[model samples]
Target: MPVTDVITDPENLTLTIHADFAAPVERVWAAYSDPRQLERFWGPPGWPATFTAFDHTVGGLAQYRLTGPRGEKSSGRWEFTRIEAPTLFEVLDSFVDDAGQPMEGFPAMRMTLEFSPTAEGTRMVGTSHFDSAEALEQVVAMGVIEGTKMAMSQLDTVLQDLRAYAQGKGTRLELLDDTHVRITRLVEGPRELVWRAHNEPELIRQWMLGPDGWEMTECVAAVAVGDTYRNSWAPVGDTPGQAFGFEGEALIIDAPRRAVTTERMQGTDGPTTLNDLNLYEEDGATLVTVLIEYPDLATRDMILATGMVDGMEASFRRLEAAVLV
Candidate 1:
């Protein structure tokens, strides 16, 4: 367990948490700054957070939602007020709705996170300042202490590993639920190059070809919301496969950071899937995460059974060898 102490003061209207990790301060700070690593332990065991918007600069805002075991979601936002790199950062945290507006009846709190070097490793100290004693009591009554303990307990695994998680794993798949699946891959390239490889027609054609014997016949780039993108692939020469294609409309586009789209097979009226792609860079590599939401369990299973991961792995390898190189 990472948490060493928890103190609640009704008089001061503060709740403080102290956690120790057996890792360097920089490593621990990376676990918090990187959204992918943050997602691994930002919520309790049953609820996992998905950060849709994260800006780590002063005056920036982050929006995230925690999804329960039964698909229930609670949204929240953080407005960053102070940032001092790997040592200290502070934010105004508040509960928000799906539209990112603060919800009524829930009080906002100022949260300060501080990290310091320790004899053993790193010490993480967090304090939440509430407006009134009643406001502090309200969150405590909502089981915030217990939930935070459970959430921070999972961070040990994230910090202990030297090899960054999923760095060598070509393409990883995690079934989030019956209709939701997440795919992650560490691309050996910078974020801007990876983002461009997915958007530019020429770059996409060079790496997105699934296998050795296929070629991208058509590629239509989508750069804005509501814009449509279509891609087709055909087996070249005597390669044994029929031509197929996919088409989608961009729903949200955030340049080199994230994109959300609705995708479906070409020439078919079947149900569409929501694909959310996020990119985060550290050191010199970028982590690409795609969360796909299918229509039902049957569709999810059918798609996975189609050797999609293997194809994605092949494409990722080609991306490094051909485009990123």
Candidate 2:
């Protein structure tokens, strides 16, 4: 699990939370931008939230209710004051009555959410400024800290499903054969943009590496039927001149649509694998499907045992973030 840190400053009357996700900044931002996704994880465990009104632009208003296990309910309203897509937003949040009016004698907080790129993925920093120390303490006594942590912890699964649904897969994995594994997902970008991210060496270097602290030191892409490409990566603290990577040949190339490659792993005496990559536009987004064929069932099973699926998922999530830029 990624580290989640919460800090409260009595002098400043602020509560700040710092959390990391193995996803791109844009995807993380979607949790707030998309009301349906927001409602899915906005409240703590056992207190599911429902959004009655949501407007994402500046000066918009959002109203929601959280129902407790014992049939009790709490309502809140957020008045948005700032809008910055995939990066930052600011809102004034306050308790609301059943009729959607602000409740008197309750605390209101000015909240700011900031997303930034990090070596591993995206780091979200959220700060809530209360009018007084008493207000901050009031919220803390209401389990705001623990509730927020529980809500944020649910993001990993949300992101996984989001990526899959965006690609039209809906959390399903397709297996073609004993020696082949196919991954199909919706990339939230244009077909050309998604293709460029996959075919261009620089763009590939930006997101293809599995996680943070790893750099693709060398990247070369020749997008032709008979052309070849090579990519190499090194960990941040590794000694200079020590790197591991792969080189592959482009067996088939159909620009911005489909391509096939024969890949060989570096520093290993393993059988070469064939990769078939296809991209298409569907319902205003790009659908990307990748088929990886190993030499045999044993080889495929061995690779799967190394936890490559998780690494691929992380890489694809980063790719989703990259093309949005």
Candidate 3:
């Protein structure tokens, strides 16, 4: 199966982030304690941020920008409720403008981040709590559910790099899933190289379809099936992009190996896809292949008519260079 990004069951509203930084508690604390330093690595990979006030003392608050609501665009903030330095930091985060006006009825969601010293470095956990069931459901419908995943996805990378910097050596994160989907490399490349390419922007954009007068602008995955897949892609001018890109949860994901899964979205209807990736090694050569299975006979026909095969080919070529080199 493929990797997914969010919890869509309405019942599964708690968003969590549990990770370890391969650095001492002091080092990890330093990264978060300094507002100047914290902004350097907040939110997801592409979304840069700016902080207003950051006091890492007890009962201090931290405010920053991640984005605006309604694409009102630019700047988001978090108002702190509790702060305990190297140990914990809590706040209410939302898509508020610089003026601190929150989005409609969405209240300031409370989040708590905890830091504990580990044998190697620091162990961290991020958890958010909504004020009410109604508010939680409302935000989920408003796309914040997936938006949060994108934010987390970006943070995962930042911490990973920070760990490498602290340890002076790279560490690997292996996520493999079990499902009918298959993953493989049609082109020859080492597994390590291909993995890195998946994280590269230039390479991702090459086959991301943003240029076909369309794009896969926002790809947020929750890492499991029945979670959430939110894609927000818009046309540069008047290209009239196809609906809201792609959305849905991952059926399965097999990391450091092959994976298979499908993603669905708003306009895609019952748009379900079954993907498969197969990986094999021969004399240090890695071969990977990605196959997708559409739901129902009608969807299969629809995909073929949309030149999906060509799109897949283009995507693989881009992946080859992005990952292989």
Best by lDDT: 1
lDDT of each: 0.87, 0.78, 0.54
Which ranges in model 2 have alpha carbons more than 4 Å from their true place?
1-3, 162-325
Model 1 TM-score, 2 decimals? 0.66
How would you order the candidates by lDDT, starting with the best? 1, 2, 3
Whole-model lDDT, model 1: 0.87
lDDT comparing candidate 2 with the true structure: 0.78
lDDT by residue for model 1 (1-325), tens: 7899999999998999999998989999899888878887898755668899999999999889986543467888999999998999999999998899999999899999999999999999999999999899999999999889978976875675423676787898878679888798989889999999999998999999997899999999899988999999999999999999999998777688777788899999977998878776777888787878899999999999989999999999999999998
What TM-score, over all chains together, does every model reach? 0.66, 0.51, 0.42
1-325 per-residue lDDT for model 2 (tens digits)? 3437899999999999999988899888987788867765787544557799998879899999986533468999999999888899999999999999999888999999999999878999999999888999999998898888877765665666544445444323555568867666677788888888888887998788876667888898968878888888887875443467888788766677667788888766667887777675655676676768788999888877866667677777888776566
Pairs clashing within candidate 1? none
Sum up the clashes in candidate 2: 4
For TM-score, the strongest prediction is: 1
